[model samples]
Target chain A: TQLLEQSPQFLSIQEGENLTVYCNSSSVFSSLQWYRQEPGEGPVLLVTVVTGGEVKKLKRLTFQFGDARKDSSLHITAAQTGDTGLYLCAVPASGGSYIPTFGRGTSLIVHP
Target chain B: DAGITQSPRHKVTETGTPVTLRCHQTENHRYMYWYRQDPGHGLRLIHYSYGVKDTDKGEVSDGYSVSRSKTEDFLLTLESATSSQTSVYFCAISARDRVRNEQFFGPGTRLTVL
Candidate 1:
């Protein structure tokens, strides 16, 4: 089983603050993804990083995949109240496996 | 919205009682999944179906069972509810793309076992 560990399980900040969340693993993945979830709703995908050392940006959010493919990160610049939510990192299982390994999630609270 | 939905958005049942949850999708997606979300546990896959009448176990499949009799419906059943099973359940649909794979989720179902 692949284990994914996320840091700063809980975070709180005021508006205009920039924050970064990290996801690390001992196992390598072919692809890594980041997702944000609101309460009472299922998680929605933010970005998918397929290659190592790849970066993708969505508006004010930036995502990076580690060169080892065992880690990933999400950085929010000038975060707003709407940025408050749980962030997750996932890796799809390898070798004909379709199940994605999920992180416990980082609960972020951005106050206006 | 992915046209995915879960029935009985909220349910409360006692221990040793059988409970079934339904997942319906209109997208005709080839893959359907069942997951449970708990604080500090994120989402754990319980079961998934790759095609009609074909299903497989996930990381946390104990005490739970799933069936996919058709292309659009997947069902999850708890033989006898347990307090450990109290958590928010989510159903997701994904259509395998040649380029990349993405999953679309439903609102979710909150089940509390007493």
Candidate 2:
């Protein structure tokens, strides 16, 4: 079974601070997806990175896929209270699998 | 908000009791999925249906069962609820577009099995 490991399970920072969270796995993947989930709601897709060494930016958030396709990272610049939420990384399973496996996720708490 | 809604936004039941959750969608999407969200476990798929009367088990499908009799409704049932089964459940619909393959989720139902 392929697994996605996320680092810094919990983070608490003040507004205007920048932080980075990571997702790593030993298995290679064709694509990876990022999601942000707030309290009492389902996760919302942030971005999907397909190519190796690919990077995508959305407003103040920047997401990058590793060159080996075994890892991904999410960086938040000048975070605000609205940035407080659980950040998750998900990847499609290999061998024609339709199920997308997800990481444990990194919970961020940005205080204003 | 792809026209998806889950019934009984919050439910409380006792162990050994039967529980059923409903997912209704108006988007007419072919693929509908049920997942459970827990701390440190993220979203784990319980079951998914690609078409009417066609369903498949997910990574964690031991104590759960699902049925999709119509295109717009998917049902998840727990024959005998257990304390460990308490968690927030979410229903999602996907267009299955090979390119983006993004899933739109509903508000989710919080089930507490005491």
Candidate 3:
């Protein structure tokens, strides 16, 4: 099983503060995906990055894949209370299974 | 919100009792998966189905079983419940063969075994 490690297991910040979280792995990935999960709800797909050194933006959030395709980062600008949730990174399982292996995730809370 | 629905959103059962959870989708997706979410463990795949009557075990499939008789319905059954089985269960669907593409998840089912 391929394992993805997420940094900063927990984060609590004030509104309007900027923050960044990371996901890293030793295995090379063909593609990576990010998902945000709110309380009492299932996770929602935020974005998918396929190319190495690729960067994608979603309004206040920015996602970047490493040049080696073994790491990724998520930066949230001017965080708001609505941004409070668990952020997870996933990659396809090794051996071409296409099954996803998820990171433990980073739990963020933005206080108003 | 991909038309995925999990039945009995919340359930509480005693040990040794049999429990089953249902997942229904309207998207007609060809792939379905069952996962359990627990703290420190992330989301662990329990089972998945590629087509009707075709299924495979995931990372944690010991005490759980799944069956898909039709395109839209998938069922997960626990022959005997245990405290260790208590967790939030989620059902996901994908339009393509590879889960690396995109997946739509159900609201989730919180199961408690005491």
Candidate 4:
């Protein structure tokens, strides 16, 4: 099974601080996706990185895919309480499967 | 947001009872998926359908079954509910776009089995 390991399982930061989360895997993926899920709701797609060493930014959030396609990172700048949620990284399963294998996820709490 | 909706947003049932969760989509995307989210496990795929009547199992498909008879609906049924089955269920849809494996997700359904 393809597994994605996420580091810093839990994160707590004060508003205006900056933090980064990492997702690493031993297997190569064609594409990688990042999602943020709030309590009592489903996850919302934040970004999709298809090429190695690709970077995408959404407001205060920056996402990067590794050059080996085996890892990714998410960086949040000037975090706010609204940024508190569970962040996940997922990769499509290999061989004719579109289903993705998800990381354990990082729970972020931004205190004001 | 994906034009997906899951019925029975919250449900509580006894063990051994049958439970079914419905996922409806308006986008008519060719791919539909069912996943469960728990405290430690972020999201695990239970089943997915590529097209009408064409479905496949995921890593954790032990006690769950899915059916997709039409383009807009997918149903997931728990043969016999167990306490371990309790979790938040999400339905997602994706298109054939190569660059974007990004799936649109529904609001989700919460289930608790006693």
| Most TM-score-accurate candidate | 3
lDDT per residue for candidate 4 within B60-113, as digits (tens), equals 899999999999999999999999999999999988476557788999999999
- Which has the higher TM-score value, candidate number 1 or candidate number 3? 3
Candidate 3 vs 4: which has more DockQ: 4
The fraction of correct interface contacts reproduced by each prediction comes to 0.49, 0.49, 0.60, 0.60
TM-score of 4: 0.95
> Please, what are the lDDT tens digits per residue for candidate 1 over residues A1-112?
8899998899999999999999999998778878899877889989889888999999999999999888999999999999989998877756677776788989999998
Local distance difference test, each candidate: 0.90, 0.90, 0.92, 0.91
Ten residues in sequence with the least summed lDDT for candidate 1 chain B: B94-103
Which candidate ranks first by lDDT, i.e. highest?
A: 3
- Docking category of candidate 4: medium
| Winner on TM-score (3 vs 4) | 3
DockQ of each: 0.54, 0.55, 0.63, 0.65
Question: How does candidate 2 fare on TM-score?
Answer: 0.93
- Docking band of candidate 3: medium
* lDDT (Cα) of model 3: 0.92
The sequence of per-residue lDDT tens digits that candidate 3 reaches over residues A31-57 is 899999999889899998989999999
Q: Write the per-residue lDDT of candidate 1 for residues B1-114, one digit (tens) a residue.
A: 679999989999999999999999999999999999988677989999999999999889999999999999999999999999999999988885533467888889999999
Candidate 1, residue A44: how far the Cα is off, in Å = 0.7
iRMS of each prediction: 2.1, 1.8, 2.1, 1.6
Estimate, for each residue in B1-114, the C-alpha lDDT of model 2 and write its tens digit: 589999989999999999999999999999999999988677889999989999999988999999999999999999999999999999988876664467888999999999
